[model samples]
Target: GAGVSQSPSNKVTEKGKDVELRCDPISGHTALYWYRQSLGQGLEFLIYFQGNSAPDKSGLPSDRFSAERTGGSVSTLTIQRTQQEDSAVYLCASRTSGSGGYTFGSGTRLTVV
Candidate 1:
């Protein structure tokens, strides 16, 4: 993909069900980040990964949320035991580690019903 591409642009899952959102970053970029935006809210960083840098998982809301990067390219965010509060837009952004414009995916709108 020329830019970040996220799977399942919209997902509606029953409460307590787990869901996985995928992200494909731009080719040759080294920095990738995951963020969540609640209803009309600012983005909350979830994780950050840069080539060889320690994965910054500090922003993860709980153990129920986890993500992984493979080959420094694609990533996946998984949410477990979803609650109504879990409903939000999961966004993926990628940029060159040193300097570059961040490209954000359309985002996955997860709604827990």
Candidate 2:
């Protein structure tokens, strides 16, 4: 992809439902990350992956949140049993090997009703 891409710029779901978001990173980049930001809030790191290294999933709010990257390119973030408080923007970022900054996607605006 020419730039990082995220699917479904907006999502509205009822409480307790599940939603899945997608991200396609820039070609040849080796580092990926996911973060969350509530309306009027700051970005919060959720997870990160760098090649074969152990994924840093420390910031996931709960076990119901999970993600996976395939072939070091595309990634998916899945949320289970959504709650109203979960409404927020889910952002994805990627950077080339040894890069100092990340390129972010437009993000998926998830709204849990």
TM agreement with the true structure for every prediction:
0.96, 0.97
Runs of candidate 1 with Cα error greater than 4 angstroms are: none
RMSD of 1: 0.9
lDDT of 1 by residue, 1-113 (tens): 78799999999999999999999999988999999999989999999999877889999999999999998889999999999999999999999878767899999999999
* Candidate 2 lDDT by residue in tens digits, 55-108: 899999999999999887899999999999889999999998895989999999
lDDT at position 109, candidate 1: 97
Quote the lDDT for 52 in model 2: 72
